[model samples]
Each structure stands twice: as structure tokens, then as C-alpha cells.
Target: MAIDPTSPPTSPPRDTPRLSTRDKLILFVLCAANFMVALDFSVLNVALPVLGADLGMSQSALQWAVTAFALPSGGFLLLFGRIGDLYGRRKLFLTGLVLFAAASLLATFAWDPASFLTGRALQGLGAAVIVPSGMSLLTTTFAEGPARDRALGISGTLMSLGFTIGVVAGGVLTDALGWRSTMGLLALFALIVLPLAPGLLPESRTPDRPHLDVPGAITVTGGLLSLIYALTTAADHGFGRADVVVTLIAGIALLTAFAVVESRTDAPLVSLSMLRRRTVAWGNLGGLITFSMMSTVVFVLTLYLQEILHLSAWETGLVFGVQGIMAVIAGSLTPRVVSRLGARRTLVAGLTGQGAFMIALLFLNEHSWSVWLAAVAVSLASMPHVAAIISYGLTVTSGVPDEEQGLATGLVTSTQQVGITIGIPLLGVLATTSDDLLSGTRLVMGIDAAILLVGAALIALGLRTWRSAGSGAVEAEPVGSR
Candidate 1:
């Protein structure tokens, strides 16, 4: 049934409809697509040195290869979400998928740094559109129940799997088929998804969804791009360059203006009133901290493995693979844990475990066996951290109405990307300024520990409100109803 977007959703009647197999397949396809998008980002890291040599890219240019994708994916997520709502989600998702596939094809053949960077940016834009719209589709198709929980669980597992496998696959492809082939493979996958999508995926329900907020989108996108550009340049430019100063100042002013506009607009791209709620505010903030600290942890550990331990790129990636195993285990068991322990307690326990593990890592040295022991420590350490992040995500979206879910999902995604962006620069500074690499590694880990603790504290403090308001069952609700 087409949604009357201007009217709030009426409570469903007595008979809850069962989902068709087509619905399930559609969700699975979209999840797989999203997984590919996420995996390509990190998997490319292992192959960058090779790509840099091949294309004659300087460190700055190579960095842009990564940052270009990230900035667009993060910065325009809110804009894409609003677009999905205003237009039709299924239509936008399909459009994004086509664009993404085209970009991937272009990336596969690119011989120059400029072309590759452009392809990466386009791919990021595609992700920005596809992700939230795909999510919106899932919610509209599923009803509130066990079915939705299972679908979400599957989607989450696919994400974890993607992150785990992407690095390994990227390495294998780079070694055997070449870097271009890896990208070509993604294009093939996207093409496969596109044909199946039209028949399987559900259309957007919002018939009178608000109009596209063009000024809001442009201003916010420009502000985010400027901010990211400034920070990324600062890594090489020492933060003193005139361009950096100008970009930073302009970015701040534009973002400030965005906040003011959001407050005053009748149908804001992002509803400020939604943020005023304690759950949305605290939950997203905690998520931001969690992702930021996690990004730093990965950065520092990769450096430690490669620089100090003298491990090869493939070997370093292999070591990090243990975290993926741990994440998969945690993600798989999350539903059961939420059922048994409740969301609040589960989140608390996960944060506590992660923070403790990070603190213990501060004791390792160049000669110590603790470095080898790290594999086991990290495996255990990743569980709670991943679980807590998943838990907090569950909390934030529980309160969002379906029409605005795209916005909610976009906000979370944006927050995470922004966190990782900030974490890279801050932690990079700490690592570069230290006397030795090991001390720098320790400082980074210690800072990660502190950040996790703060995130934990926020989760703990927020638990009271969540428990009183109730948080879990809603997230576990059927995708159709969400």
C-alpha cells in the first residue's frame, strides 16, 4: 500500500501480514551491497602502497583516495536520506547503485591519480545515497516482530563479514588479479544486484514526504567537505597554511549556519526537535566516541605491527583479522545477549570489557611477549566494543518514526564517519610527535582506553533513561514495522 506521507501511521489492524520470500531476498541483496561498500574502503588500505607506486601519487594524493570516498559518503548521507524521503527510496537506491557500479568500472581502468580519485568520490556519493534508502526499504517491508529482528541481525552479520573479508580479499586480489581487478569485481557484483532489485525491493511509502531541502543539502555538504579538506590537509600542511585557515573558518561558519537553519525550517532536513530527546542525543554521542576510539585503535595497532614489529602489510592485516573473528562472534550472539541480559546491561558490560582490554595494552613493550599475546587480547577485546556500538545503534533508532528513519540512519552514519575522520588526525599527531614509535603506540592505546571509558560512562549514565523508557524490543522489531 502506498503511504499517505502527510498523515502519521495508523496502528496496524489485528492481522499482521507475513512477508514474502521476495522481501527476504531483497533485504539480503541490499545487505550484501552495503557490505561491499564498507569492505572496499578498508580493503584498499592494504593495497595503497602498491597503488601509490603504480600511479606515482604522493602521500597526499594517496590519502585523498581514501578521504575522498569517506568525505562524500559521510558528508552527504543526511542529504541522501532526505532525498530518499522526498522522492522514492527504491528509486533513489536503484539510481545510486547504477552510479556506484559505473564509478567502480571507471576506477578499474583508471591509470592516473586524478581519475582514480574522481571515481572514489563518485563511489562515495553512491554509497551516501544507497545505504539509507536501502535501510528505509527494509523497515517499510517488514513488520514489528521476530522477522524484523532476524533481518536486522542478518544485515549486521553481513556488515561484520564484509569488514572482515574485505581486507583479506583486497590483499589476495592485489597480489593475484591486480588492484584493478578487485574494483572490476565490485562492479560485477553491483550489476548483479541491479537486475534483481526492481523485482524484489519495495518502493518508498511516503506519498507526501517533504520537499527536497536543496539549500540545506548544499550548505551542509559544502561545510562538511570544507572541514574534511582542512583537516586532511592539516596532516601534511602543519595547520598553518592560509588555505587550511580559510577552509576551517568557512566550514565552521557554514555548519553553525546549518544548525540555525535546521531550527527555523518548517520541515528541516534534520529535525532539531528529534535531537532534543535524551536518547537520540546521548546514543549518537556515545556511538561517535565508540567509532572514533575504534578508528584510533586500528590505526595505532596497524602502525605497531608494520613499523615496530616489522611485519609485512599482509601479515599485519592477518593479525587484524582476529578482530574480525571476534566481531563476528559478538555480532552473532548479540540478539541472544539482548534477550538474556537486556540492552542496557549488555552495553555496559561490553564497554567495560573493551575499556579494560585497552588499558591492559598500555603495559606492552618492544621485548615483551604481550605483543604476541595481543592477538588473543584483541579477540576478546573486540566483542564488547562491537556489541556496545551495535547496542547504542539499536537504542537511537527505536524512537524514530518510520518516515524519518532515513534521517536517523544517516545521522548515525555521518557521526561515525566524522568520528573516524577526527580520530585519524588527532591520533596521527600523537604518533608523529612522540620520540619513538612504541611510546607513540602506547599513547594512542592509552588515549583509546580513555575514550572508551568515557563512552562507557555515557552509556552507563544513559542506561537509566533507556531502562525506564525501554530500549531493546523496538530495535528487534520486524523490519516491515520499523
Candidate 2:
């Protein structure tokens, strides 16, 4: 007879208030890798022009340097996430570190346009492996409740800070040491982590291993790849382009096929049944909305500050510095906040506050007073935005059993990646279409605010503290779901 892998993962015990040295080491290793990935995501942005000139990449080809990293990272998450569970998370994590380091080296030494894109795509592949594997390990290592919440809070904080810092670092590094130095930096981080991760991290797996669901994996991976490619492409070229339209259609068709395949498969790559869990369902939606809207806010503001307001890059960075500080503040406060409000209400309150502040940005323009207030509002919004960012991870991972932890986290991380990937494009197209850049930006912000508030309201009405089934889900009423 075989054991049900859904039962709690074997461990000494859980719920200890203080972490042992080993526990801290585990957290450090995992959180550091995630932080590096977050940093790498944006570190290339400011360095893109310098990098392109060195490699002779054209303006059209330049975006591919970024897109190359994004495609595989967004596409293969579901497949690799489940692979880690079926194989070994520790094995998968270590392999990811190795791949990441090697890919970084390749990008560092990249001599031509082709080589650079290949290296970036490989780096993206490595990142796809790292995120879900790291998340599943973290969730399983610490049992649910405060312990897991706190760990995720810290993890979330570092990731947020990494993105914020990466932008500034990209500019400074590009100017100081040249563009390749940015690539070298990530290689350094991965090299440092690769050797220690194997020894420090505990290995865990699904006790009852089932055959890999090839059909489900194929459809989902293809769908996501196509969809993400389309989104990234549309960001640069308008949606009217033939490639964008065709890819968009193909992506939708593939995903619909994936759903059908999953329903029919005996051992699906992702357990569709789990989506019924209120925690899983609402939680993922919340995660997607929070990340997308927040990232959109940042993107539009970057344009408004630099292009519209004609602020220097340094001044723009200064205005948004408040966000980085709040990310740190939330890390320390999240555990206490979640402990008191519970993940459900904490997410709602965080979203509500974040949305409110987003609305406050609508007043922003050339007026000195409005500009000052708008800057302050974004900083104030950062508190709840960071809170929402951390809490949503807790909400999604809360009651997921060990067996499905990888898949659960895979879905969660996919939302995180896709949310960030899509937010700019989805709203950016809107911003570009408007008659005036300022009004367009303000319009985009208003729409973003509405989306956030509406999402928060839905989660509030839909999620409950009380568990109806042994499963984390309940019959959530849809209140302005979108």
C-alpha cells in the first residue's frame, strides 16, 4: 500500500516560535535566490541601451533581449513546478542554480546578438525552475499559519525590494562598469548559492508518484508561452499586428485545450479541483490583481515622471524611493498583521488602502502641489501594496497540502510572473492611445484604481475565515469578479 502524499510532509515538528540555525539558513538560501531572480528581472532595463550598442542590436531587436528572458520564465513554470515535486525539489533547485549561473556566464560573455538572446532565454529557463521549486520548499518547510506566513512575508519583501533596487542598480552599473557587469552580478549571486543550497536545503517529494501528465503539460506550457509572447510583442507593436492577433488567438485556444486535457487526465499536471478552494481561487486572483495593478502604477509613473514631467532619471528614482522603504517595513509588520487580521481580511484591507491611494494619483499633473501629493500617495500606497503582495502569497499557500504544494506554488508564481509581465502592456497600450499623454496616464491610473478596488471588494465578499470543507475552499459569492 502507498501513503497519500497529501498528508503533511514528514518533519521533526512545526509551530516553534524561534527558528533554529538550520531553519534560518534554509530561509536565507531560498529567499536569496528569489531575491536575485527579482533583481535580474529589472536590472537589465536601464542597461538595455548600453547593452544594445555593444552587441549591435537594433531598436527592434533590443526588446528581445528582455523578451528572451521572459518567455521561458513565464511559459514553463507549470511543467517545471510539477517536475520538481515528482522528481526532487532539492534536485530541481540545485539544477536551477547551476543553470542560472551558467546562463549568466553565457550572457556575460555574449559576443553577438544571437548569443545574447540565447543566453537570456536560457536564463529565463533557469528562472522558471527556481521560482516554483523555491516556493514549494519554503511552504512545506514551515507548516501553515504564522510560521509559513512570516517566511513568505520575508520572501515577498526581498523580492519587492529587489525589483525596486534593480532599476537603480541597472543605471548605476551600466554607467560605472558597463552593461556586462549587470549580467556578471547575477552570475555571482547564483554561484554563491549553488554550492550551499544542496547541503543546506532539505529534500521533499510526493510520496505517491504518478505518471507525468504529458498532455496537460504540453497544452498549458504552449498556451502560456504563446500568450506571454503575444503580450510582450503587443507592448512594443500595437495589438493590430497580424502576429499579435494570431498568437493571441492561438494562446487562448491552447489554454482552452489545456483545460479540456486536464479534465480528462488521470494525473493532471495541475489539479483543477484545487481551484475550487476559496483560498486557492480567490487568493490567486488577488495575487494577480495586486501585482498587475501595482506594477502598472510603477510603469505609468515612470513614463509620467520622465517623459511628461521631464524629471531626470535620478529624480524619478528619488520620487519612488518611498516604495523600497515600505517594502522593508512590511516585511517586519506582515507577520503581526496577518496574525491579527488573518490572511483574508489583511488582503482586503491592504487592497482597499492600495486602491484608495491609486485613486489619489489621479490628481497628479504638472502642478507642483499635485505632483508632491501624487508622489506621497504612491509611497503611502506602497505600505498596503506590499502588505497585499505578502499576504496574498500566504492566502494562496495557506491550507495547501504537501503533495500539491509544488503545483499550488507553481500557479501562485505563474500569476506573479504573468502579472508583472502583462501589467505594463495591458495598460500601456491604453496609455499610448489617448489624445494626451498626461490625461492618458491619469486615465490609466483611474482604471487601475477601479480594478484594484473592485478586486478587493470581490475578495472581501468571496473569502471567509471559516472553512466550510476540510478543503480550504468554500462557495464564494462573486461580487464584481473580473
Candidate 3:
């Protein structure tokens, strides 16, 4: 029988497949890669002082080791994401792993600040490719609904755990094997993962592959780099610094031009129409809010625990270690929560819960008992953070085609990095403005809580509208359609 070409195409029913051995192996490799990238972000923090001393770096110059990595990692995300979509995700993923490993090796052997910084920057570039490509692989491998949800839950847990692991690992490695061990460990991990990836991961690319959007890529990458640089610099140098102001303005102008270019380009790096989708738009916004507030909490707590309470680095790591454990447990439970309440409602509940916990931080003080209370508050906060992360990821990627999964994941990852970059400076300024540190901490916590609540409200409203529109569309369909 010949099918009529004029007939409307039917959507495929969402199906969940049982995980086979190969499937499980693929999941493990992807999660491990995600963990490595995330771990790189925080693992160096504990080693920074010792590493700097060994490299003869001054106090101020030491900060660039972090900035060097962060700038390219965040800046190149979108460009690489689209590249994965156009080229091949598996190839990009493999390239990222190899590059990251080589950079790690270089850093391990670096004899000076400049050499180490070069390695760190290269590692960042590799991570820029790894994260989105890795995520695209996950989404494409697992079918939507239960399968993708479960995979995302595991992936998010590992990512959150990676940060905690990095903190603890950095301390232990630096103390036992010296600062070089930190970079060496990363190199070792990358080498272990590299060989397995080629056999385990599958290749994927868009069907109607379009030409690369050079102009859009250039403008967006330049813009994000400038913005991130300005944000980070403002944390140490005042916002009024001439270079910071100039860079900030240039970033804005370039980003505006990117929007214009994307709107008119034949093969756009980011589809403007995708941003108009409710889930992608609102989900990214929610992610932005979650990461910014959560990161600020970490920054403020670090100061409180160390400076005000006079706790050692090990003690602070222990406190966060407990929080990280809770985050993993929470991430494990997210799939169940989503099954019960759905992604939108889950997101709202998670956001609200996190806000409530942030409000509880208002009572924390310098007393020993207060430190325990702070730990408890942080532990409780992790549950919602994990929930929100998984839910937002699902929401953003839910209906997107496999071809654009890289782009979608890129947006999510980019917002997360941007949030982290902006949060420290934005909230740091607030914490510094007050006369007293305790008073400043309280003020910032209050503001963070408010922002979380506002974000929840906005998401809840968006969900309501989406549901209403969905219902209307359904009702308009013919009764005998099936």
C-alpha cells in the first residue's frame, strides 16, 4: 500500500527500555566523564595555595589559575555544543577526553606559573567540549520519559558529587602526595576513561546538517568570554575599574549582535525559536536562579566557617562532604518524585524547599552548635538542589529532537557556569558592603531566599500557562483521531 505524503506525521510514543549491560556501561562512562569535568572545577581550589607556593606565584596571580580554566570553559560551551550537533558528538567527546588528559599531564609536569596556567586553560577548553557533548550523548541514548529521567538523575547526582569529591580529594591528595598529585590524578582518570569511550559511546549528528555558523559562534564566544572575565575580575578589582567596565560593555554589545546574527543567519548556532519554547526558556531561567543562589550560599558559608568560626579547611570539607552525600541521595530519589508529581511541579516544590532552607540560614552564628546547624541546613538544601537540577534538565530537553540535544544541553550548562561566575561577584559585593560580616551574611541570605521564591512563583505560573495551552490544543483535535 502506498502511503499518502500529504498526511500529517504521527508522534512516536515515548518508550522506556530495560537497561542492558552495554547500556549500563555507556551510562557509567558518560557519568564518569561528567564527574571528571565537574570535579575539575572545584578540585583545584584546595590545591591552589600549595600549588601557587611551589610555582612561585604571588597571592594575586594564584587566582588566575582558576580564572584561566573558568574563562574558556564557560566561554566556548555554546560554540562547541553546536559543533557537536553539526559534526559528531562521539568524536567531540573523544577529542575532549584526549585533550583534557594531555592538559592534565602538562599541568602535572609544569615547572612555572605560566606553564601551569597554559595547561589549565587547555583543560578548560577541553571541558568546554566534554560537558555538552557528553550530555547530548546521554539524552540521545536514553529515550525520553522514564529512561532519560533516570539517566539524568544519575548524571546530575554524579555532577553534584564531583564537586564534593574534588574538595575532599584535593585536600587528601595535596597533603599526602603534594599539589602535583591533584593534576596527576585527573590525568590518570582521563587516561582510564579515554580507551573505553570509543567502544562504548555511539556517534550522532543532525540529519539535515547545516553549514557552521561562523559569525554567530565568533560573536557569542567573544561575548561570553568578555562577560565572564569582567564578572570574575570585578570580584577582586572593583567594578569601576577601567578595564572591567570596558570589557563588560563590549560583552553586552557583542551579545546583542549575536542575537541579531542568530535571528538572520541561515544555520544559526542557537535557534531563536527554541528560546521561545516555554520549557527551554523558563527551565533555563530556573537553572540560572538555582545555580546563582546555591553558589552564593557556598561562597558565604566558606567565609563564615573559616574566617568567622575559625574552622580548618578539613573541617569545612567535612561539612560539605555531608551535604554532598545528601545531594546524591536526593538525586537518586528525583526520578521517583518526578514520576509522582511530574517535572513542573517537582521543580516548583524543589525551588520552594531550597528557599525555605536558605531562610533557615539566617539563624546561623559563630557558636559551635551553630556550625552543626549550618551543616544540617546545608544538607537539607542539597535535596532541593538535586531535584531542581534534574527537573530543569528534563524540562529543557524533553521535546527537543536528538539533533539539537547538544545545543539544548549547551544552554543549560552555559547558564550554570554563568550563574556560578556571576553569583560570587554579585553576592560578594553585597556581603562586603555592610559594616559587619555577620550582618552582611544575613542580608545576602535573605536576598537569596527571596530570589528563589520569586523564581518558583514564575515557574509555577509558566507551568500553568503551558498546561492550559496544551489542554486547548488537545481539545481542538478530532474526537476520533486515534
Worst 10 residues of 3 by lDDT: 468-477
For candidate 1, lDDT tens digit of each residue in 252-332? 988888888887788788787777655567667776776667667777777777777777767766777888888878877
Residues 279-376, candidate 2: write the lDDT tens digits.
Answer: 77888889899888888888788888877778766666777776788779977887676665556677888888989998888888876566577678
Models sorted by TM-score, best on top: 3, 2, 1
RMSD of 2: 5.4
- Which residue ranges in model 3 land beyond 4 Å of their true spot? 1-17, 468-482
lDDT of residue 376 for candidate 2: 85
TM-score of every model?
0.89, 0.92, 0.93
Kindly give the stretch of ten consecutive residues in candidate 1 with the minimal lDDT sum: 473-482
TM-score of 1: 0.89
Candidate 1 runs further than 4 Å off: 1-20, 144-146, 235-238, 467-471, 474-482
Candidate 3, residues 1-482, lDDT tens digits: the string is 21111222133323334788998999999999989988898888888889878999998898798899989999999999999999999999999999999999999999999899999999999999999999999999998767888899899889888877788888888888999998998898899899999999999999888999999999999999999999988876669889889999999999999999999987899988887777788888888888888888887887788877888888888888898989989988887776555666677888899999999999987688879888899889989988998888887887788899999999989988998788878887777666777888888899989999999998887655443111011011111222
Q: What TM-score number comes out for model 3?
A: 0.93
